[model samples]
Target: MKNRWIALYVENQVGVLAKVSGLFSAKSYNLQTLTVGTTEREDVSRMTISVKADDTTFEQIKKQLNAMVEVIKVIDLTTMPIHMKEILFAKVFNLNNEGKTEAFQIAEVFDQGGNVKIVDIGVDSVLFQCTLTERKNNELITLLKSRFKKIEVTRGGAVAVESISSSCR
Candidate 1:
């Protein structure tokens, strides 16, 4: 199954997220990532959810979401020309000076044009944080696995929007 991203514009109210998530759980659809935040209009909230499903399952999810009272709009982002990003903070342990230097180099390469940085450095653990596209984030993880001992990782689920034609561009 391919990854699908769904953007849901919903009324900002209690139990909205729960109700939305409950639908997926009830249907046995696997949700890979879900990020929710308020939009510029405080009364509305946007939820970006990533799931692995085929066309039939995705259509079912969309139908159920549209039926919900809280959901204002549902967009399938998978086929859209979208700008997507995710934040990841990874800690690597058991590093010596040589390992630390290697980690630094890895961070430099993966940082989205230098946006990523070393957030914390401990005696044995080093934390690096970066906001990157999904592919780059996975690349960094693969590098860490092959080169260093990974202690833990925290990822902010992906947030995405359709790429709109800008007058400035």
Candidate 2:
């Protein structure tokens, strides 16, 4: 199966998300990640949906989504040159001061000069916030999984847009 990313611009009204989700369920499609937020215009919302499907099914799904009444635009980002990222919020159990220091060091190294923030540090736990590419995020999770028992985890589904520039190299 090929992974696909689709962005939908829709009217910000009640039940819009439900209707869109229902369409996926009705078609027996599996949605991997879905992120929704208001656009520049308050009445319009942007949804980024991630799914895995074959070429034919991808086309069919896009067509159906465009036919929805509240949908303003549907962009298939999978085939485009786009930049995408996912945000992660995680809480790691820290049993002692040594564990806490280790957690902080891990976060510092994993930040990679990006938007990684230490949200909280308590006597027995540490919370972190990171915005990273999907691959890096997964790597972080794996690293943490081997080290600590995660108390909580949250993933902000991917958000993407077409790339604007060519190689600066």
Candidate 3:
């Protein structure tokens, strides 16, 4: 199955997040990523969700979400032109001077116009913070894992918005 994306407008109420996530769990639909935050309107929240499913399953998911009372609107974003990014933090330990330099070089190479940077550095560890598309973040993580023996990684779910003029994904 390929990845599908949806944007949900929901009431900003307590337990709304839990109920929305529970629906996915109860249906056994695998949610790849889910990020939610309040919109400019304080009473509403926007959620960007990613799931891997076939076309039919994806349609069902949309229908189910639309039927929920808390869900004000559901927009299918899979084929839409949108800009998306996920936050990633990676720390590599047991690094010497050369290894630390290598880490800096790697961050520079993946900078994408300054979206990646060395956020912290210690005698034996270096932390890299990156904001990039999900695919790019995955590639960075893979490279870091291959190059370092002791590493820790944390990732935030992707957030996306419709492109204003140009097409992007």
Q: Which candidate achieves the best lDDT against the true structure?
A: 3
How do the residues 16-132 of candidate 1 rate in per-residue lDDT, one tens digit apiece? 999999999998998999999999999999999999998989898999999998999999998878888898898999999999898888888766676688889999778999788
What TM-score would candidate 3 get against the native?
A: 0.98
Q: Lowest lDDT 10-mer window, candidate 3? A: 160-169
- Model 1 clash tally? 0
TM-score preference between candidates 1 and 2, better one? 1
Residue 147's C-alpha lDDT in candidate 1?
87
Q: Which portions of model 2 show Cα errors greater than 4 Å?
A: 167-169
lDDT of each: 0.88, 0.88, 0.94
Tell me each candidate's TM-score: 0.93, 0.93, 0.98
Best by TM-score: 3
Ranking by TM-score: 3, 1, 2
Off by over 4 Å in 3: none
Query: How do the residues 51-85 of candidate 3 rate in per-residue lDDT, one tens digit apiece?
Result: 99999999999999999999999999898899999
> What tens-digit string does per-residue lDDT give for candidate 2 at 1-169?
8889999999999999999999999999999999999999999999999999999999999999999999999998887878888999989884588888888888899886766777888879988899888778888888888888665789998988777885210
